[model samples]
Target chain A: MKDLALLEDNAPKPGLWTQIAHPGLFLGWSRHLIVPLAVITAALAAWGLYLSFWGSPPDYQMGDTVRIMYVHVPAAWLSQFCYAVMFASAIGTLVWRHPMADVSQKAAAPLGAAFTLLALFTGSLWGRPTWGTFWEWDGRMTSTLVLLFIYLGIIALWRAFDDQLKAARFVSVVTLVGAINIPVIKFSVDWWQTLHQPASVIRLDGPTIAPEILIPLLVMTAAFSMLFLTLHLVRMRTEVIKRRIRSLELAAARAAAGGAL
Target chain B: MRAFLAIVARDLRLGLRQGGDILTLVLFFVIVGTVLPFAIGPDRPQLARLAPAIVWVAALLAQLLSNERLFGSDFEDGSLAILRHAPLPLEMVVGAKMLAHWVLTALPIIAATPVLALMLGMEGETLLRAIGSLVLGTPALVAFGTVGAAVTVGLKRGGLVAPVLVLPLSLPVLIFGTGAMAPMVPGASGQALLLLAALGLVSVALVPFAAAMALRFAGE
Candidate 1:
């Protein structure tokens, strides 16, 4: 009995790190940040549009269609960024067992999918005027398509499980496993594109492109990043509240059962 | 070591005794291979051109057909529980099961590839390269599929989930496998073959630990 009592007394408690990482602590702060984040995103987006449409010069070779790069490139960057965040959250779920990590991962999937779809859509629209074809199975395009599929797969895995906790862990493992393909996709797509079309190699940010184009692209990228952060924070808060409600309902059901008995 | 061999032997025996599924996998491969020429028209040159891709895709799908059961039956019958409690590492248990799966499913597909190559009108050097690619690539396929199967083993309809989860992960294998047989690419085939072997080696080295963890989670 003494040993048992000592064991009880020495039981592990949530550490300082977990306490800091807890979603509830951020709940009030997130609500406050959302409005400011939205305003910043909107202001930047409006400024970005002004620069992209009016301030930026038309490309010497491609002309006005160069403006499409403002949307397509930023969406492409965010798609990869979102996956990287999900991958980090996966590591958190598996290694540190962080409570909020899985919630963040689950919240980020649809956003990543949306960004990937926008990249593909805007890319194809840009392609028709530039490449004379709307779609080409080149390395970058195909890999982006595969990335979209992966995002959908993760989302489907999230929906497949009825239990959120189990779903989170399973999704984490899947995310880490899928993380293996991200670099391969990037490398192979670049290599494939270079091999098939040696002349028309699309550089991510080449020095040849004037600074006028670069500034708007950077602004647009910032705007997209801020938007992702705001959405991710809102979704995470929703997930936490949903989980709390679920647990309360479970406890209430147990209490009612006990009373009836 | 002895426990690993025993688990492998036990699974192999169970697979051989229940061989109907093996037959189904083979038939699936043959049917998919045979139907492609008809769907694409009986153009001999086109069939020859598509033969390597067709064979690789069929092998991928056929191998996938059996992955859901890689751990499902053992898990359902409580054999996996006994293995879990045994005096051996769970990773070894998983490796042994995956090895048995490759033996039962992938070996038959490899053996049947030359025949599928013939049906697709591929000949001589192309058939040889196709076989070489399959031999090097299938281990990776089976390894990743085992991970998928382990992840979904707890679900009642995990079989459906296995392909979606595994297919994207297997893209590199598909690309390199087909790349290995593309005659138009001068020195690329050799590089692709080496990469495919590397992928297989990495998958062989890494997947068991991941699969074992997934199994443990499912067991919980």
Candidate 2:
């Protein structure tokens, strides 16, 4: 009747590490994925580097440094997009208590945090060459900072509990409810005269980018999405292993007591 | 409904008996207000610009300070179990607790803001907005804090944990509560008010059931 005790008793059979550690087997389920993702990412980075130096056109407005958009834009886009995934997963967990929803929530936090950092880093990089300063209290940046804080909050809340299940549930609920910030960030530019430009790529009508630019941007977006997937699979595997190890340790202690008896 | 009122009144009496609790919150508010002006320096214009936010933040911290005891006393004394078993729906019980919380904690914070306003040299239209916003806003804070307190109430060290868990959820209130008073600031105070009201309505409708469920889980 005690769920935690039952979970400990049913801990994954030993050697889960050996099971997943094989490079070929590990890469099998992900081979089609690993090869294509790597190829595309490298190609895009190459294309981006090429464009940064040679092939790509300059921003009529922003000039050569606008090239940072290749990285910055996708990072910002994915950061917000990852939050949307986290929020959805949070809702799923809170409303239905789906088991996988916890995995999804746990997986999404660090990804979102990484994306946020990428956006800020590339943003600062782009800003230095373009805006003559690296940081500003513009609404977009402020909300991005808020997004980072929310991510940190999620991680902190998750770590605050001694009981993992309780911590997961608590953080899950908070993430879903706190998602009100996503829309707020998107509309911040429109609502306030933010220094960040209004939406140019995703719009009600359609994307306004020239095909030449749009293609690379879309490719990069795909590459980043795949990167998140690959990282997610690895992280979730690690979490599952970690949980199994914890249960095994607990079971060992319990078994030693039974033997003593 | 009458039973609910009785519960509310009973809670109010308990709150009154523990008068020092509310007094401590007001004292925290006063001390926080006093320290902020000195910390930020004596420039009047800067104070005027910062006063609304500072007051709201201090109020939030004080509310959080008081939130630890919100359900802990009753939950520990087995009173919460009695309330849960009572004929009233958990939502009603939650509502009553939220009302008691507002009466004890938020009401004083709302009242204290005007005094803080005076101390910080706030004048005219902004002062009125500060009072108006807090009056409209703090109920939602109390309601939201009730849910948060309920969620974490069963955990050890939950008091410290609750604020970090709740603050992000409380941002809309903070953003708007301060926005309502700081007129030149770009946030839509009216929209923020609407959101705060909606938050109160939703929390009132849902939180007691949620709290009840969380309590069950925690107790188990």
Candidate 3:
């Protein structure tokens, strides 16, 4: 009943959206998160977009087409990274029973799925002119497709449950257990001879790409991270509101049942 | 030990009384394997080259189909509650159930692989490797499959959803199973069997308890 005060009092307020959506609380959830994130994202995007189109050197072999790496490589990184986030969140939620862990995990799923699709599409696009085929059943590509399926499966399992709590727990288990595939996706190229290039950015000797390319790739990575943050926050707020509405409806139903009795 | 064996025998008896559960899974494996060559064309060399991977994949898929049998009916009937409350730990009960499942589903796949290999024109050393890999790898299938089955046991339409949850975790088996047989294709046997054996050992040690916990959660 005490928790219901916010719902009972605020449900009729039209001006609540402006207050709830205030960027201050969004950014203030963690101290100084938004400012640094905004600065880094803007700087990187500007630098990367400039170099990708105008400044970065063309590969001696691939020419202008190599620019797509600025997009494709970062997307590939984020797809894997987002899944890791989902996986870690899932584990945290399950083991510690952190409520936000569930919220963040659910929020991360669609974001991860989107990144996976973009990675696949971009990889296919890059493959067309480079590999002379739109796709290869090579270890990396095949594993990426598998990763996408894992994402879809998690999301599907979550949506299938009527109770959000039950669904969250189910999806959490699936994500944590399926974390095995992340390493496979990351190291698939090295483990198996594949058309996809071996790790260039995070290798032991360090990134093989020049600063020009690396800068943009890092920029794109930041942009992708920020995009994930923005979207997840929005989605989590939506979930919290939806849960509020559901509880209110249940309360109303109980009250009506009591009145009839 | 009696508790363990009793559970195993009980599951085996249940599987038998159900009459066609084990046979249907084996039949599904053979039929799917046979149909694939037809669908893809009967190129003998190609089939021979793919025989190990194909047989393993078919076995894995068929293993997925049989997974629903692991805890589905028992969970629904509240027998699982009795098992959980029994003096025997839930882990041992799950372990016994998983072993029985291996004997029923995986053993058939392994037994039929030699025949399936012959049909695909796999010869001599390759055939041996294929069967050997299945023998080593199938336990992992049961281990992880039991985990997935436990996780989904209380949900509606759990049977359809279990494979999607299980398949990714089972990749080590698929990878090592196929990898182990790779050398036999070229007339040599290699680390695939070694890795397959390792995965089986690890899964046997770890998966049962994890699966038991998952079953406890689903039951809740």
Candidate 4:
């Protein structure tokens, strides 16, 4: 303990941000965050569920089925939100070489993918009732599907590489390159929908949704965001630990080889 | 500029040395187009209607087929690292390689497009526009494909994996390329061509840096 303490004292001091980003310090600091965030997520989910199903009144046109918006909207929002997080983390990995940044990126891809898939699945279920078809090759749906594939492809890239550090640089380049699609997806509706033909079939853009419906949608989005944060933090922790185990195993193998020599 | 030209010339010579590889891509592209009409039933008007979409899809796939080949040999032979440390920047090296790739693979495919177009019963103005769209759009495909190639250079079985990473990003190019081929908007040379040009310009401008970065790390 004295040797450990002295070693800690001998280490050079880093800035607050740099210290926080250190994987060792991240492990120490992020532990306190998990439980609180998890509890908050649970609370918000419960309240949001109640508001979505029970508190909000039925829509006059579509009736109770309109409640699907509470879940669908948030999942769609998270799909984009998670990509944005990964893109930022990728920048962190490349520009600053922050060790935690790649871990954050790796942790986020599948989560973003899950949310994108959820958005697609729920959107289809809602579509059957609303658009009278389970699938449409419209701009918004097509872009989201492409986004899902991008996430899956990134995961495949991760699996293909043996060295995680080497993978980070390449993945960061791909992630940054893929970022251009985000704005294209965001404005897809506006670009393809109007001027010649109005959105008579799909009335998705409710710029003036009622307060009761709006409140639940916002609450559910917040809950979903918290859920994502909780999952991301836990996943990052596992990845950091997994990498630690990898290095330790390598070291052990080297020692055994040296002993034979 | 001389160094960049030399790099381009080297890649071109290397590609021409194995010239059958270029023929294979053109043949692969033609067969992909040929097979489509067989599946969809070769109704002349229908084939004409679908020709643009077919050509673009085939072009995208043809570009994808050569992605791993772009850097696989160079990295394995340690030439990539040599190129990296060359006086010209890695980005310029990448751009030169991309130009060579476009010449060796895509240019042959485009030259062979007329044969596929003739087979599909397409003619005249639309055929010209189709080739125009390919000229404008393929640089973007080459950029993305080169980056995909660079990204996968470190992987043992990267050839199979390059398409998985590249195809999703190729969506916009496909959309605009197909649109540009058809006379979608009749007025004033069409909007799709302009959009295709923008996508091409932006992708060419920005994507080389990414490819260069991937190559840099691959060397490390």
Candidate 5:
């Protein structure tokens, strides 16, 4: 009775960090999220796609090529958005030392890279007809490409270390360094734009875009956001299982070694 | 103070002990410069126009050659482990190492850049501005590279990883560095110079802590 009471007394109340970061608890809740989230993402995506392709009118200046904006804008937004999540997760890993945060950071990299590449791809598609060139060395395009490279570098860093725990620390530093770097590069490239283009160049989408196009774009972005959330939660759950499997494998290997000894 | 100086001195002494290494970096820098003309065609005006950018890229690549070893030797010998526990903070040690790296690697390249630029047909103020940009920008390069070095120091195949990681971060420096080479307006390059210096100073100021954090956890 005394020992049980002592155990109860000693147990620390979970804080916000712990509540959010507990991998087992995360797996439980995230499992529930996966289905509903995927369903919503699909519905939103269909609606968004329908509105983008059929519902909205062709752009005045860009014609039908403007439809590519629906996919391109969201991918571009998610590219930065995913990095922001990774950056926060990195801070969480460093400060909180939580496996969930590490899982998020590890999971977000490839997704971020995919989004960045998509941004580059869809952007080039849009660029071809609009600019009469498949590639333009403008600040936005160049910076996005650089952002893609940064994402790849982070992914590479994650794979470089044999020990995942140690990798987390190194990755956190790199992520933070990258976060600091992104703005500086953005500024510098935009500044370069001033040098190369003394005259203002074409805007991808002019400010105050008509609501007909803007609503669908926003809906598609929300769909992308939902898709990213569903994927992120699912990835985090898989990472939890992967870690468990890794530990079990390590333990079995140790047991075998012990038996031989 | 003494401890900080000691790291810088130790690294400097060790770097100097390997004489071919410095020569190799300078050679690499020049070779990159020489190869560009062949690939891009040796139109004098075109070469002159591209000279500043060529120098900046070569300088960055040269810095990368030394980055893989920035902390590897010490980490291998376990001195890095001890240093983490030492009286001086790891940030100070990283800062010292960064300074030493800058001194050994970047300085020689900076010294040789004017010659490379001159050979590429950049003359007078353009050559001077290119060199000036190097003076301001290379520290930012080293500062960011130190973080890359510190991040990858634990990896077995860190060489390629450091460049991949460092190059994107170096984009701003490349832009502003080349910007300072030819001021569009008379005072324009000055603004580029100021931004480059800010990048260098800001990076130099903050990178130590980040490197130190990475070193600490990676060591554990």
Candidate 6:
């Protein structure tokens, strides 16, 4: 019992670490965090854009057209990353019942969809110049299209419910199910792509891509990741405030009814 | 086990009494399949090339159309609530409902595939392979659709949401199912069939638990 007391005394008081860990505590600091995050995002995006456009050289074969990768690859990466965020949030909602999980998941969907759309659009633009078509049933592109659809489906599911809590639970289940199916979908699409197109140009053998091109790609990816973080944090803070406003209105209405009664 | 079978029997009987629902699904399948020849022109070779894909797509759509009603009616009428309180586990109840749904909806569509295949100018070995693929694939479809139906059961516009939720997940089934029927693939058909069966078995074994959890959450 004395040893337990000593251990308890030595333990850090639920201060900065606790505040960082607790979603509700972070809510209080959201306003403080948002500005810095937004500024960081903007700065990184500007730098990344400059690097991609001027600093990087045109591809040996594709020339200036390869620059589309700066936008497309990053958006594609964030598209899947946002789904992964939602997937983790789904597990949090279902398994641990995290208060902020559903809000995070719901907030992330539209952003994911936007990134996915950007990826598809840029990919098609790239394809028109390269493959001579706006669309190709290539594995990565098709699977990403399906991912966009899944994101849309989840957003629609969220809209279908008037009760946000109920929608959260339902969407969480669907998101987790989608997460499980994603690998299967990708595998099948890869198989299907192989059947139709034997030679794929998107091989990632290190020596093939020059350092100058790869650097911009990485920088752009970092910029996109920062952008997602900024957006997600802002959205989550907004969701929290929205829920608070809703409850306050409901409480006020109840109090007014009680006074009348 | 008895209670499980009883739920299955009851759902089956309820489905049979509403037999027109099944007929409508089959007719929709036929209509969708029939439209392809006209839409793409009556070029027999083109239709033959496209037949497996058309049939699989039609089957998927037809299955999706029926999924909205899988748990919606029970949810609305409060039977699902009573079933939740029954001795049988909700997972088993879900399994039984999916089984009933497969029997009532998917089997009829699979049975109607031969006619649709004929209309598409697919015959001989290819038709047999198509039928074989549909038989193996539709259970997975029904399983996936059940999960969609259960997830959306409490929503007012559940029918609208079910397809969006289910269709992407069904793509693999469509890919493998059509691949199984492709005559040009030679030994690929056997491999595709094995994969399709594996998908079906996985869906059957695991999807009901997910559906049951969704149903319980929706009920709450």
Tens-place lDDT digits, model 6, residues B1-220:
8998998899899889989888998999999999877899989999999999999999999999989888888988999999988898899899888888899998999899889988888977889999899999999999899889988998778778889889999999999999898756457789889989998999888888888889989888
Residue lDDT tens for model 2, B1-46: 8879988899899999989988888999889988998989999989
Q: Write the per-residue lDDT of candidate 1 for residues B69-123, one digit (tens) a residue.
A: 8988889989898898888989999889888998999988888888888778898
Candidate 2 residue runs with Cα over 4 Å from true position: A1-55, A180-207, B185-213
Residue B84, model 3: lDDT of 77
How is the predicted docking of candidate 4 categorized under the CAPRI scheme? medium
The stretch of ten residues in a row with the least summed lDDT in candidate 4 chain B is B181-190
Score each candidate by Cα lDDT. Answer: 0.85, 0.71, 0.74, 0.85, 0.88, 0.87
User: What CAPRI class is candidate 2?
Assistant: acceptable
Question: What is candidate 5's DockQ?
Answer: 0.84
Chain A: TM-score in each model? 0.88, 0.76, 0.78, 0.91, 0.92, 0.89
lDDT tens digits, residues B1-220, model 5? Answer: 9999999999999899997899999999999989988999979999998888898888988887878888889988999998877789999999999999999999999999878988899988888888889989999999988999888887787878889999899889988998898656566699999999999999999999999988887676
Candidates, ranked, DockQ: 5, 6, 4, 1, 3, 2
**Which portions of model 1 miss their true places by more than 4 Å?**
A1-19, A189-204
Best of the two (1, 5) by TM-score: 5
Q: How many backbone clashes does candidate 4 have?
A: 0
Q: What fraction of the genuine interface contacts, i.e. the true contacts, does candidate 3 reproduce? A: 0.15
Q: Which pairs in model 1 have colliding backbones?
A: none
DockQ of candidate 4 is 0.58
Give lDDT tens digits, candidate 2, residues A83-199. 888888777677777555666678789998999999988887876765578885556666787788778777776676777766666766566556654564345333443212433
For all predicted structures, in order, the TM-scores are 0.94, 0.83, 0.86, 0.95, 0.95, 0.94
TM-score of chain B of 1: 0.97
Candidate 4 has which clashing residue pairs, if any?
none
lDDT by residue (A1-261, candidate 6, tens digit) is 333233224435568765654555657777798889888888888989999999999877778998999999999999999999999999889987765788899899999999999999999999887887999887888999999999999999999998887788889988988988899899888877765566765533366677888888888999899999999998997887676666667767887898999
Q: What CA RMSD would candidate 6 show?
A: 5.1
